[model samples]
Target: MKKILEIIRYEYVTQVRRKGFWIGIFSIPIMIILSSGISVLAMFIGTDRTPVGYVDHSGVLASPVLPEPDGLFGESMEFIAYTDPAVARQALLDGAIQGYFVIAENYQQSGMVEYFTPDLSYDMVIGDFEDLMRHNLLQAYPETVRTRFEQGSNITVRALESTQQLNLDQWWNLVLPLVIAFLLFILIQVGGSYILQAMVTEKENRMMEILITAVTPTELMVGKTIGNLGVALTMLLVWGLCGGAVLLFLPAYALTQVSINWGVQVIAIVLFLETLIMMACLMLMAGVMATDAREAGQLTWFFGLVMSLPFIVITSVIFDPDGPMSTIMSLFPFTAFFVMPVRMTFTQVPGWQVALSIVLLAGMIALAVWLATRAMKQGMLSFSRKIKYSDLLKQRRAA
Candidate 1:
């Protein structure tokens, strides 16, 4: 345990001190900031903020209620009332307004309105006028009814068998698990890649043989796996902090106010940890079996595909959360890291399945570690040869 802690400290310190590590961690937040700046610039550039003109023929808008001020964007379009269509058309021609909406005299019956614009360029402000019309149309209703109509409906989707409920207005809840799954995949890949690279580099340098003389192969493997994973976690932590800093200045404060499913989050975290261990062990084992870095890359590509299988069939998991495919994926060791967590967001996953997944992952992790140890012991002295998977399986059966 002391040796493992030392290895962890060495790995974390070595990685965090590297210039490449700081470069990669800072790139994400910088990209996010640049993209946000571009979006806001695009919102302001070539955008017509001209006041919109409307000729309301129907008397419903005669005493129109003042539409709510929409400061979400820079500024809301002013809905200028024109008593005459001829005057509104003249205004459009004279550049008094970008466009004018001609509400039909029988708008209450047909609910049809025609928009007239000279250049066919002012298409963005149409939605704002629709909101104004809706706001005025609801004036005849009671105050509560008007408020309800203005706010729209908050549809809550509840799972009958579980405590999971999602409000449509709060779409972040449904998407949060998927985001977590993606991040987990990224961290696992990063950790596994680092483990693979470290193992390959050390083997190329004949460092494995020199280290094994002082410690057992199993200890060396365990220490290396934990140490490299610490490096990956450190990278993730820095990236999260950078992203959190950027989120502070965003206008969408509601982005942070989403419902928190602590139970599912806890399960997702456990899944991530187990999967990370299993993947890191497998990567270390592959590094031991391969004769060189190229072979290790080829072998670990399969593991990456296995980790991404849940994402490949994610549509099915989302649409049919209780379906057989989701059930199978959630129970399977390779795909459960993502499938189970995302599935839980949509529907109630059976407790038995979650328990079984946990057990399977634990068993797989142990198997991976044992296999890695065996590969390390066999390949420790084989500087020119590679260990075959068949031999490992044969030895396993014999044992």
Candidate 2:
């Protein structure tokens, strides 16, 4: 036990003292910041095209300039009037007009406006322009608003609200999957590499022989896995702090569209705890499988793909939170790390499922630690050959 503590202390101190550790830990937040800055700059500096061409047969609609729609279409547009449809179409074709609009005879009665363009984008441009024209018509005819159009008082309005109203952010299905992918990728790259390298280095130096004299390999493996997990946790905490700092210090102009939720504090805590368990299991596996730095380096790539398996599984889970596949993934020790948080965000998972996942993951970690320690005990003295997956399986069977 004392020797295990020493191994833990030694691994922690050695990693913490390395320049690479600090560099790797700090670079992720800096990259996120720089990418965010570029996105903001693109949003503000992108060129806006001036809209050209307008309605000529609009005696029914008495407006000189079409009112802009709300949101992205608000006030950043231009329109030109034309008396002849053919002339306007020609002008549009000639680039004299970027787009042309035509109102049929009795346009108000027909409720028809023809907008012509060079290609398929004509439909979108016309739809936006029609919205602009309607907005202007609304200003002139405030009586045309929905309250005036509906016959009943409270019942119709309430029915409309219930049937038609939607939470726009409900459409945000992609962010959860993206977050899952990123988290799993980090788990593979950071957590798995730490495990691989730790095993590899110890074997290469033959330090395991001396260490084994004082402590069993199980104790050494447990201590190393826990210590490296501490490193992964430290990196996560630092990145979380950096993210929080950006959120807090971001300028008002940078957050025009949405307010940052401080409740993410709770979310971050949950994520940190879950990720710690996952990394611990991965590190134990790395210790068992890696014999030297070269083999560890090669295994890192394969480990990365395996870790990403959960991320691929998450897409299906997000679409149907209660689907059979999702249920299977939620119970899976390997996949639960990616699927659980997303289920929390999109759907309310039963407390029992969460509990089951935690219990299963804990058991998996314990089993991995046992296996890793056994492998280390058998393989620690030999530095001549790489540790094969088959060898580990054979040793387990022999034991």
Candidate 3:
């Protein structure tokens, strides 16, 4: 136990102290901050709020100019009415106006309005203009009708089981699952690769033989796995802290819209832990089976691809969480850790299904660890050649 702890400590400290680890830990948040900064800068710096001309052919809209309105992103819009389309076109050509909207003579009946702009990319400008036109149009109606139109419909989406109404604007329900799955996918791919590389390095340097002399195979495996897991968890903690910090900047209403189902979150954590264990075991086994890093990389590529399948099919799971394909993916051990958590996020998953999945995953993890340990012991001395999968199976049968 002492030896195992020592190994764990050594591995953990060595990794945590590395510049590459710290850089990786900070990279995501830094990139997010930089990107956000660039977006804000672009929003303010390059965008000009030039006056927009409008031609209201409808005789009812007699006002020569509409009131200036503030845009969603703080840009001011000035609407100037024109008597003729030719004048508005001339103003646009002369750069006196950014764009123009022409309300047809039959606008009251046909509701046809045409907007001309040089920049199609200014979608927000068009959207804001549309909203302004909508408001102006609504003013023609009675107060009661205008109020009802402005208030829109009261849509209440209730769950069949609990009869609890869900908020349509709760964007977190759509976003959180994908975020969690993406995080898990990144951790598994990166951490598993690190474990594979570390094991290959140890084997290449003949350090495994020296280490095995001091500790049992199981102790070494457990220590190494725990150490690497600690590193992965540290990265997760850093990212979590950064995410929390970002949430602080969000509006109260936005924050309120983020509802967390603790049951689902707890299950997600469990699935992630199971995934890490399984990946670590497989990485160790891959390392044992290979004679060098090249061989290790080649062997582990298939496992990496298989692990990424969940991420590949995340869209399908998001759209139909309780679909047949999703259920199959959630129940399958290889894809369960990613798919199940995502599925749980979008819909209510049955307790029996969750339990069965957990049991199957736990069983597979135990089997993987056992196989990894057996392979390590058998192939530890056979460094001159690669270990065959059949040999490992035969050794298991003999044991």
Each prediction's whole-model lDDT (CA):
0.82, 0.63, 0.80
Q: How do the candidates rank by TM-score, highest first?
A: 3, 1, 2
Q: Give the TM-score of candidate 3.
A: 0.89
| TM-score of each predicted structure versus truth | 0.86, 0.75, 0.89
Which residue pairs overlap in candidate 3's backbone?
none
Answer with 1 or 2, whichever has the higher lDDT: 1
Local distance difference test, candidate 1: 0.82
Model 2, span 1-399: residue lDDT tens: 787788788878888889999998887767766797888667545523546676657564456545434434244556777777777778888877677777766766787777676765524355556656666555655554722432223221112222322133433333634553465447445765676677777777777777778787678777887777777767777876876787688787655634332233244345445555555555555554666676666644654565567667766776787788887776676666666656655465676887787777777766766666665665677677666767778888988
Per-residue error for 353 in candidate 2, Å, reads 1.3
State the weakest 10-residue window (summed lDDT) of model 3. 63-72
RMSD of every prediction: 3.3, 5.8, 2.8
What stretches of model 2 exceed 4 Å from their correct place? 1-6, 17-19, 33-47, 56-61, 64-75, 85-97, 103-130, 140-181, 184-188, 214-216, 250-275, 297-303
The better-scoring model by TM-score among 1 and 2 is 1
Tens digit of per-residue lDDT, candidate 3, span 1-399: 998899789878988999998998798668867997999888777666788878988754564323245544655577778988999999999999988989889987987888888867654456656656666776768878866675576555665775334455566565776777778778877677777777787889888888899898888888888888888898888889988998999999888778777777888888888888898888988888788999998878888788778777888997898999999889888788888978876677787889988898899999988889888988777777888778889997999
